[model samples]
Target: MEIKDSVVLVTGANRGIGAEWVHQLRERGAAKIYAGARDPRSVVCPDDRVMPIALDVTARGQVLAAAELANDVQIVVNNAAVSYRQPLIGGDVDRIHAEFETNVFGLVYVTEAFAPVLRANGGGAIVNALSAVSWFSFPGMAGYSATKSAAWNLTDALRLELADQGTLVVALHSGAVTTPMGDNFPIDKIEPTQVVSAALDGLQAGQTEVLADDISRVIKSTLTSDPSRYAAILGG
Candidate 1:
C-alpha cells in the first residue's frame, strides 16, 4: 500500500531505524506517524504530523494504550529489539529473558494488540524489523539470532492468519547497520536511513519480505546452497 497520507505506528522510534522510519514516512506524506518509544519525549521527529507515544511493547497495558492512542493507524512497524551478547545454551538466563522480552515477545504482543486495529481500519500492513542473523548464527549473540529467527516465523504465521483481513505482513532483514546497537561491531555497516528507505520502498512495492542490504541479500540467497557450507560460513 502507498504510504502517502497513510497513518503509521512505529515502535522504538526514539532513534535509529525507527527514527528513520518516522522521518521517511513524513517525507512520503503520511497523514500521521505515531512514534512509539518507552520514553515519548525522546522522539525527535520535527514534523507536526508526528505523534510521540509512550509504549513498552512487552507490556500489554502499554501496548493497549498505544493502540487506543493510535486508533487511526493502519500500518504497524515492529522495530524495538534487544540484543544480548550471550549463547542460547550456557548464557546468562536473565539476559536471555530480557532479549526475548523485547525482541520476540514484545513484537508478538504489539502485533496482537494492533491486529484488530488494522482490520477495523480496512486492512493495513505490518512491517517487522528482523535481522540477517535470523538465518545465520553469530557467536556471542546466538540468543539474539534465535529470537529474530522466531520472529521471522511469527511474521509468516501472521501473514497466513491475517490473510482474510488483508493485512500485508512484511519482514525486513538486514545485516548490522550504523546504529547504536552495532557500535561495537567493526564490520562496515549500512546507514539506518538507507536500510529504512529500502524497507519502505519494498513495502510500497507490496513485497512480503525485504532484504535491506547486500549482506542480507547474500545470506538469503545462500539458503539454497549446501547446509554444511552455510554452517561453515557461520563458523559452526
Candidate 2:
C-alpha cells in the first residue's frame, strides 16, 4: 500500500527504528501517525498528525485499547522488541521470560488485535521488525534469538492467513542496527534510516518479506545449510 496519506500506528515509537518509522512515515505523507510507547509522554510527536498512544505491547489491554483508539489505522508497525544477553539455557531464566514476553507474545497480541482493525480499514498492511537472528541463533544471545525465530514464523503465517483479506504482512529482517538494541555488537551495523527506508520500499512494492541489509540476505540465504554460517560472521 502507498504510505502517502495512509494512517499508521507504530509501537515502541520512543526510540530506535520505531522512532525512524515515525519520521519516515511522516516524510512519506502519512495522514496520521499513532506513535505508541510504554510511557505515552515519552513519545515525541513531530506534528499534530502524530498521535501519542500509551502502549505496552506486552499488555493485551493496551494493545486492544490502541486498536480501539486508532480505528482509522491502515497500517500497523510492530517495532517494539526487547532482548537479553542471556542464553536460551543455563542463563538468567528471568531474562529469557522477559524476552519472550516482549518480543514474542507482545507481537502476537498486537497482530491479533489489529488484524480486524486492518480488515475493517480495507485490508491494509502489517510491518514486523524481525532480525537476522530470526534466521539463526547468535552465539551468546540464544534467548533473544529464539524469540526472533518465533517472530519469523508468525510473520510467515500471518502473511498466509491475512492474504485472503488483502492485508499485506511484511517481515523486515536486518543485522546489527545502529540503535540501543545494537549496542556493544562487535560487528558493523546499519543506521535506523537504512532499515526504515528499505522496509518502506518493500512495503510499497507489495513485498511480503524484506532483507533490509546484505547481512540479513546472507543469513536468510544460508538457512538451508546443515550448519548455519552466521556464527562465523559474528566470529562465534
Candidate 3:
C-alpha cells in the first residue's frame, strides 16, 4: 500500500480527478503510473514515470489488454466513470445504462481483469472512485447516483472476493468535486487533489472506505441511522 516505489494504474487519467491522482502518486514517489484513458494522447502529463495506456473501461477487451500490458501494477485505481446528470422518472434509458456501464461495470471489468495480476504481484490494492451519492441519492443526477450506489456494493463484493488473494480493496467517496462532472452542481466543490490525497492516504492506512469530504463523511456516519439527514445538506 506504500505509494513509494509502487507500480500503479489509474483509469480516466486524461483529466480531472484521474489526472490529479497521477500527479499526486508521482509526488508520493510511485515508481510508475500506468495512466489509462480512452485516448492515450489525452494524458498530457509530462512525467516520465507516467506511462499512458489506451483504456476505455467499458470495453472488456481494452480492460483485459490493460491488465496484460500493466502486469507489474501493484495498485489499480478505478477512476473511469461518466455522469449524464440524468434522473430516474424521465431520464433517457440509454444514458442511465451508459452511466452504469462506465461507473459500475467498468469497475467490474477492471477488477476481474487485474485480480490475478494483483495476486501475482504480491496481493496489491484496488482503489475505487465512488461518491457520497452512493450513500444517498439526490435529484438531478439520480441515474448517476444509482450507478454509484451499485458501485458501492460492487466494491464491497470485490473486497470480500479478493480478500483470499490478499488484495486490499478501498472505496473512496466525495461529494461535489470541482471536476467537469461537478461544474453544474449548486453546492461548494472541493478540489480534485483533496479527494485524491485522502484516498491515497486511506489506501496506505489500509482503510476499506475513505470519506473524502464533510458531506461524504457525514453521510457515512448517518446512513444507517438516519438516511434522511442528507436531505438537509441537499436543501431538501
lDDT of each: 0.88, 0.90, 0.91
Candidate 2 error regions (>4 Å):
225-228
What is the per-residue lDDT of model 3 for residues 1-236, given as tens digits with 9 covering 90 to 100?
79999999999999999999999999999999999999999997676999999999999998999999999999999999998765588779999889989999999999999999999999999999999989787678888888999999999999999999999999999998999988757788899989999999999999999999999988887876365696756766
List the pairs of residues colliding in candidate 1.
Answer: none
**Local accuracy of candidate 2 as per-residue lDDT tens digits, 148-199:** 9999998899999999998999999999999898983558999999999999
TM-score of 3: 0.96
Ranking by TM-score: 3, 2, 1
> lDDT score, residue 72, model 1?
90
Compose the digit string of candidate 1's lDDT tens values, residues 27-97.
89999999999999999969689999999988989999889878899999999987766556887988878
- After superposition on all CA atoms, how large is the RMSD of candidate 2? 1.4
Stretches of model 3 off by over 4 angstroms after superposition: 224-228
Task: For candidate 2, give the lDDT of residue 163.
Answer: 93
In candidate 3, clashing pairs total: 0
